[model samples]
Target chain A: MDKKSLTRRLGRPVLGTVAALAMTAGMLGTGPAKAAESFKIGVVTFLSGGAAESFGVPAWNGGKLLIEALNRGGEVPAPYDKKGFGGMTIEYVLVDEAGGATKQVQEFRNLVQREKVDAVLGYVSSGDCLAVPPVADELKAFLILYDCGTPRVFEEASYTYVFRTAAHAAMDNISLARYMKSKGIEAKYFAGINQDYAWGQDSWADFVASMSVIQPGAKVKTALFPKIFAGQYGTEISALMREKPDLVHSSLWGGDLQAFVLQAGARGLFKRAQVAFSAGDHVIPQLGNKMPDGIILGARGVNGLAAKARPNALTTWFWDAYTKEYKVFPVQAPFRMVQGLLGLKTAVEKAMVANGGKKPNAEELAAAMKGLEWDAPSGRIQMTLGGGHQAIQPNAIGRTKWDTAKGEMTLIDVEYYAAECVNPPDGTKAVDWIKAGFPGAKCK
Target chain B: MTLLRSVPAASALAFAALVLAGFVLPDWAMFLVTMAFAKGLVALGIVGLMRGGLVSFGQGLYFCIGAYVSGLMANWTGITDIFLLSLLGVLAAGAIGTIFGPLLANYRGIFFAMLSLSLSMILYGALSKMTTLGGTDGLNVAAPTFLGYAPEGRPLGLALYLYTSAIVVLVGGLMRGLFNSQRGLIALAIRDNELRIEYLGASVRTAMAINYVIAAVLGGLGGVISGLAIGHVDPEFSFWTTSGEFVFVAILSGYLSIPAVFVGSILLEVVRSFSNLYFPNTWQLALGIFLLLVIVLLPRGLGSLTLRRRKAKEQA
Candidate 1:
């Protein structure tokens, strides 16, 4: 071909590609009006690799189920009519945090700004949650923090848009201390093995405070906080064993939790002292049947419990629905997914009523999230004002009961503890609180 | 026409324009733009090494060191001012780089790459172990201060960004000057045939050692800028994966031009954001595939690929 013809041909293709891209983008930009009317909820969670298969996978399943239920419920009527806002159909966009704070922050931005999501639900790691709180506040998006249990969220509870459905480190630590006291076990020496980060550090602080209150003169024999994403833990385990105390507390979760359990079991660390793991659900069932009996375990939230009294119909319905859908009972962290959905429902309902039965936008939604209370699968949840926003809720602590007949690990003496009793008083800086001596700072 | 000779005036003007736009743009755009400049700085550092045929995969270590130094210093000393912290950060990384450069200057091929990767991992391990620096939680670094003005929020941030970017571009110009000089010729000689350069009575190790220090200083500056841009600095900034990413940016841009590195970094961030927006689940896979094709098909990197093809056709 001649140069003129060849140049013309190339130009045509380049122009055609640009035109095509623009047209395609325009078509996508204005999706059918009906599709645009739907209330889109973006669910961000780690879903690949070993960590996802356990905590994130189950949490996603729970979130999926809740979305299905919300869609099935249709427009609000009767008692819920006051709460119903727009003719909204709920949809979800799932994102992976991938175990990085910066990545998770960027993901949050993409969801809130680019995707124009109405609400966000799902996070299983403390790092992701910590990374998100400031951004969520800045963006003014209604963020339902489903499963990051670090107390830092509450400490930074000034963000009116953020609300957590899961139990915090304070509740878990305080509940365990109270439980131990009730059991007439006053242990003097204490040791801890937790994943190194804000969550682990907060857990240790809360545990020390509560333990000191219940059993005075409790000496911290050892405190080991290993980096969270480190693959192997033989060194950390050996160190914990060497520090040998009368009691050991751990807050490791996900793959880290399983690795710790396996190594501790193999190395006879579990058998050394009475072990109390906060968020022990990650190791149960998958290794529960194999876990040596009488380990004195507890997950952050109550799961796998069979109450002596007849359970509530809603509770029964939730369990049946969850089991039928997932083919397994809900565990600790994922259980927050159901709680998150329930909390969001409560917020939406309250907002709708407050707006005089009108549909709410992002700002109204953000405002409604603050000071909201709801009854969820885990129990009552309350959002308190502090830095950005934080929710204090009930927590369940239970022993790992293996029923040889059923071939499972169950929570036998499951007990619910109020979060307010153990939580550090609001408006107090963490640095000052630590220096002043935690839950017992004022009490003493 | 020489490739480097074609574009200085245009780039200088473009950098000025970006700094001005940073003020009017919203938070998100400001974040993205600053990120582009920071990544651009790192790319420039890699360009220095690439000029000598050495592919250093551990720029992340230097970047992390810069960031951590600023973060640690700020938190420990309550010095939230941007200029002081950044200068201190660069100095800290440069000092450490001098030590590391000598150790790495003698190695070549896969050995050099592996050594850099190991160094980054070692830094990651150390940072994670040091709880006072916030460990895995990382230090929440504050924004830079300029002459008693807080340059973090909106208006002032834009001005500060402009000042910082101007320095970066000026540094790029300086790099260009060096690349066109005697030292650059010898570096190219090393790239062509190190054995011949050594036989010519030049101490290759000493030359490479100086080159290593230069790259380290550049990488450290990039790190400090990135830490300022991102608002937080963590140990992951020093991980092997992060280091590999810098190397990927270097490879993607090729060593054709100083500004190509900036474009490459911007392109990477843009592609990542775009991929996440559309593909969601398999975006990383898509990125991998795209990068593979680009590397295999355009081995000279994105900057050189178009020019190389056009030049060849013109010659024919």
Candidate 2:
């Protein structure tokens, strides 16, 4: 048990381990050396969490499929036919967004500072979207917010390095109210049951504001703000039934939406009053026939069944490829993720063209993406809001019916709203615009 | 007692080495190390409680208070000075501890743990509903400046890392000094038998209260550093899961050494970061397995290794 004998036993292994660590550390710091080689993207989504099953997993799945296809080269349609991001060979570093905002910020810094990723496409949570932008701006890294629906991201502050290539919550709710009014669905009174957090609250506020304008005389009977992911809706449904309004509006999605449909449908609340959901079409495939007929829904844009009727070349290829891979029709989550990735790819390639067919830096990428208009499976998306940072895309609303042959709930009487028809103009906030009676709205 | 005289010199050298490493380490590595040190301070507080045979599950109470105070100061006053923010955090958390410490000293064992647990959860619930305070999404903190000297990017990260290391060194030395003092021995005696200490006229309540106050101060300081380093603060700072992490590090390092706490914390961050990088899908499974192995093989924790080596030397 002498010191010399203990040292003899442990010294070699300890020294060897230390040497290995040092070598690895050196390898990790091989940052800019690899920048000229391939275009590295940090694709962050929820690999694990409650959101993983329905939202995050599908988003990452679609992202992986798209990135791999892009790497394979010429699979995607025109203008995007070139190899991985103008033939630089697109590489990805996937990080889970399951952890909270602080963890996300740290991981973001790691991606840019350590991993040397040229750009990052991430986040399905609104909190994370708002949290990451300042860090992105500080680190001078280009970040594309794939699916976070918070308007506050671009509304609160302008950032040189941040962009959300998918439409925020305003369009979803605004489109819902406009669709209801255009169809003349209901006359007098309405109630709402939405989640209480930022997403739900913001959605409810937007819907109410839209209702106040579009359906001017409709009185609000009641509004219930259930907590996010509060799966049970018994009491909320009971309260809604008790109010006995002509219509019920909700922005509930994912599990909360599913649970509300089941609980309220069992109580025959839908029969008592017409129900409309913002961002609800993703649940149709999961709900099948159980999703009540005559219920109105939006896929945040021309997504899911709304896009089924319009199969352009790019749309047809993306739709078939995604269905072939995942074995289910693509929903809003996957569609939004693909849209963000596609937009990022287009921007990178555009920047490369300007840079004489070389990799573009963050500033170059940002410049290329500013006010960029591009095609998506959801139709054309334009950077028209938040001073060319936030996206404004076409969105649709439809009435659902249980189709016998399809053995699923499918949208009927679908109506598409152009990007300008739903989203607010640049320098105008969504709520303020809605409250001001949709001034300067282009409805054609 | 004479053997303890070299602690200040040894610790100064150790701290000097750590600060020097900040100059050479990459920004991300510096950030990771900064986090380990900040979180390690909370573990050190838990270790302080461990010495007194009390485990405070509500250390998050102080942690959150420290963070919110510091964050609010930055947001409200535009004073982004790290020293002033940390001073506010320490003072606010210290005052809260002073008020609650004696009340908490009245309980023991599970009762003590649960009481602390409830206090933090209350803060969590309360913060989640405050819209002006940013609610569940929380508020962002700007990168703090060092005494009016604003550093950006690499230099900023390095400055924060070095500053945090210096604080840890000073506070850790204070803790080490307390452990060697007669008051520390009295706290340990209170742990062994409160009834005996009371019978010996040592005022067990006062000793326990003092120990609690020390933990609150440590927790607050740790919280301020963490909140500023991460550049964001939220109710999650007070969540039970966050407190549980501090406890986990405390158990991993044991109460034997202050330096061992940072090692354990760094080990955890490294394991977590690498595991997540390598195994994105099942990183939780990897982390759970790693923790299980640590608990099984090192019952007294990694700190026990040092204790065993010292004992072996004595025997030889």
Find the candidate with the highest TM-score and give its number: 2
Give the TM-score of candidate 2 (chain A). Answer: 0.93
> What value does the lDDT take at residue A294 in candidate 1?
66
Model 2 lDDT per residue over B1-316, tens place: 2454577986788798997787778888888888888889888988988888989898988888888887889889998999998999889988988998999988988999999899898998888878788877778777799999999878888889999999989988888889889888888887788889889888888888888888898889888888888777888899898899899999988888788899888777777776676688988898898777666556567676667667777799
Q: For candidate 1, what is the DockQ-based docking class?
A: acceptable
For A243-336, candidate 1 gives per-residue lDDT tens digits of 7788888877777777777777888987778888876765665776766676665666554452211255445666778788877777665567
Off by over 4 Å in 2: A1-37, B1-5
Q: What is every candidate's C-alpha DockQ against the true complex, given to 2 decimals?
A: 0.23, 0.40
Taking the tens digit of each residue's C-alpha lDDT, what string does model 2 give over A52-167?
87788888778888888988988988867888887887888888888787678778877888888889999998888877888888889999998988788888788999999999
Scored by CA lDDT, what does every candidate get?
A: 0.70, 0.85
- Report the lDDT of model 2 for residue B267: 77
**Backbone clashes (count) for model 2:** 0
Expressed as tens digits, the lDDT of each residue in B20-85 for candidate 1 is 666556555455556667777776787788888888888888889888777777778978677677
Model 2 C-alpha lDDT versus the unseen true structure? 0.85
